[model samples]
Target: MAQATLESAAAPRESAPAPAEAKPRRSGKAATGLLTTVLALLLALFIIGPLVWLGVRAFADTWTYPHLWPDSWTTHWWQVVFGDKALGVAVQNSLFFAPLTVLVSAVICLPAAYAFARFEFPGRRFFLIGLFAANAFPKMGLFVSLAALFYALNLMNSILGILIVHVLGTIVFMTWIPSAAFAAVPRSLEEAARDAGASKLRVFFSVTLPMALPGILVAAIMSFLASFDEAQGTYLVGAPDYMTMPTQMYSLVLNYPTQVAAVFSILLAIPSVALLLAAHKHIIGGQLAEGFQIK
Candidate 1:
């Protein structure tokens, strides 16, 4: 009788219906998931909507007010943007200056980054803070203040002047990003290589650089984009003769037909988009965040 009673009680406990709270818990989770998915889709729509509209306008011959779609579509605006000689010069200037600026920044800033990462030096903290301050200053105001110096040095309208301006803006990116990258590298690996009969230089080149490459690559991409897109300083220092694609947009917006401006806008965006896509892997792999961590 006792054994039978125990079994009967255990069976009742095992076969009891789930707690009344269980259904509501499950329903709540499902509701939360549905809300999250809806929010994600809305955010995506907000970002992509403008780009979709821009694409529409780029090929549209006539997209008047109140029209959801273009009345006519043609590729003629593309041809117009390509055939313009002045615009071609601006495009050339952008292409030529951007890479060259990256090179100059890499040469000057990489070693400084290495020093910042590896050594404890006087004023190091102050210098790092200074880099932030340089970037923090109001960009247009900074450029305006420097214009007087450019005039004094006859740097106005000169390639060297424009190059210097671009390099100035990129210094913080080149220094800060690579410094964080180098700091994150394992000193143990470098030391082990040194113990295995590798020279310090060899250890650095073979071990440190490879490990920190993603962060350095991210920095380079940022520097390249900064120099490529800089308009305020470039316009202030090198206007009229040295107008890059961004600066040229000002003229286009003012004087050119709307479609012409749209086509040029697309062309201007292409290189930046292509580069960001190329670096997308490194960026998404957390190197960008790693480099910006200030550690």
Candidate 2:
């Protein structure tokens, strides 16, 4: 009888109903999830709306004051802009200058970045502060001086002039980015390679470079975009003959009052987006994502 009673008690406890506490908790979670989804939708609309509007306006045949939508939509603006020989030339020039700037900037800045990140250089802080300070100054501030220098050197209106200026302007930023990237690499990895009889150069090439590649790639992409999209200096230095897309856009705006300018703007953004996507893999590569630990 005692055994039977004990067995019955255990069975009832084991088969008991679930506590009511879990019911409210599940309901709270579902409500929170619904609120989060609504917030995300709102944020997406806020960001994507402007981009969609620009695309719509670019395609509009006749946009007017106080108009929410164009009276008619057409591809005439795109056809005209793309069909122009000058537009083709501008695209060519931008393509050449942008990649050249990225390459030159990377080459020139690599040594400086490595030194800053790895060595005990004198006045490093001062150099870094100066770099940030230089960025704060408007590009326009140097236009007059740069133009005068170019004229004196007989480099005005030359592609070389544009390329050199873009390289110099982008170097400061490229160096800083890679310096931070190189610094994020643990010194222990380099030491281990050395202990295994790897030379400094070898270790750098095999270990250090690969480890810091993502940041380097990001910096390169940024430099490319900056050079590609730069308007002010390119216009000042590359006027008349060396018309970049930006200079062409200016010419169009001055001569025409249509949405052709928006077409150019959209086309200009293509290279930037393409470059970003190309570098996206590197930006999220396993080595960078796991090893670098950069915030």
Candidate 3:
């Protein structure tokens, strides 16, 4: 028995089963990856192709259909846009109002954000949901309704009217985003600070505020962009005397050459693009999604 056991132990073990064939699985994954890349490229073209074409049109002197590329390039439209007085005023109004709306929104909504974050009050969910009421309805319909109200209040055609309209677009982002941020702060940190003899206010300012600041800042960026991009409401309520850059696009598209409009469009997109590029990391980091959690 011992000799037989030794022979068995010394003998070569039966070969272990070979790994299941992976080529089919690897090929399937490769095919899926290739398909995803193609789809992504196509989607990118669909979204970005027009922007590229616009850039081309802005410089193209006489390129038309059937041409794959611009025939000639010129700076005529650029010079014309730069010299236009009305366009200058529109540019000024956008730059002026967007930042102020962000500031006003922060003041009015930050406290509300804090409340929603820290307090458990009756109707909290209802109120949180209500934040979308401003933007939930069709924007044109909402603006039309505001038009009558503004007319009654003697706000029509004034800077104040435009600012108010811009502020309306900001409330959701200002409240929801910052509130999400505040809620995400770990209570333990605040408790630790409190146990160390720090007051509630002090703990909030030192710990809570610092941690949630990223969300607040992301909200601010979004608010600024929305206010800047708003057109329909601004046109309905603040037109004729107080045109913003976006509202000015109506006149550009209708009366000016396509190249001229394209140039102005590029100008209008610059700030939005710059701000988005700057805050992209925060946005991609998931704060915007966190803001939608009404609970």
Candidate 4:
């Protein structure tokens, strides 16, 4: 009789349905996920919205202040930007200064990098500190001195003159950048090359250079951008008759309106962006990680 009574009680418990609490826990998790998704979408839109608006404005015909969207659309801005004589000259000047500066910086800085990385020299830390210190100074402070120097040298309005200034200004930073890169390379690899009867110069050219090429390329890209984007130095030293894109954009804004200024800004940004893209592969390579290994 007791066993029968226990069986009757257990039978009712086994067949009972699951509790309501489990359903709400699942719903809460789903709600949190949905909220996160919504936030991410909003953030993406906020960041990308301005670029899209700029593109739309660039392609539009009307650039009046009041309208958010264009009343009409045209390619006149593109045609004017592409076909102007002054603009063409500005582009050519930019093309000349940027690469020349990059080349000059490499020529001047590569030896410094190699020495700092491969050799133990007295006051090395002091030299690197001083180099970085130069980079940290406000570029504006050097303008008057540079302008005076250029005037004294008869280089005030010349393209090559402007290039010399760019290279000088860029050297400190480029040397530091490549020094870090070269320092990352294994000393053993270089020593091994030497043990195998390779001359130091040959080892540097064939082995060290190939290994450090990526960082060197990145530094060159940076040098090119710095030369390309320099405004105050170029303006103060070589003004009026010579117009870089920044100087031109400034003139347009003061004389015309925001729309024209925006067009020029967009055009000015293209070459820098193109250079970064070209150097992207090297800058993102694994050379850095490998170099840092103590072995």
The most accurate candidate by lDDT is 3
> Each candidate's TM vs. the true structure?
0.90, 0.79, 0.91, 0.78
Top model number, TM-score: 3
Error of 2 at 216 (Å): 0.4
Query: How many clashing residue pairs appear in each of the predictions shown?
Result: 0, 0, 0, 0
lDDT of 3 by residue, 99-177 (tens): 9999999999999999999999999988887777646898888888887889899998888888888998989999999
Which of the two candidates, 1 or 2, achieves a greater lDDT against the reference? 1
lDDT of each: 0.87, 0.79, 0.88, 0.74
Q: List the lowest-lDDT window of 10 residues for candidate 1.
A: 1-10
Ordering by TM-score = 3, 1, 2, 4
lDDT of 4 by residue, 13-75 (tens): 534654555455545545655676678789888997876777676678765778788889877
RMSD of each: 8.9, 9.9, 9.9, 11.5
Q: What lDDT score goes with residue 185 in model 2?
A: 85
- Which regions of candidate 4 are displaced past 4 Å? 1-47, 63-67, 281-295
**Per-residue alpha-carbon lDDT of model 2 for 140-252, expressed as tens digits?**
98877788889999889887898887886787658877887888789999999999999999999999999888888888887887888788888988888898887788888
Clash pairs, candidate 4, are none
What candidate 1 gets wrong by more than 4 Å, as runs, is 1-22
TM-score of model 4 vs. true structure: 0.78
Show model 3 residue runs off by greater than 4 Å: 1-19
lDDT (0-100) at residue 267 of candidate 3?
97
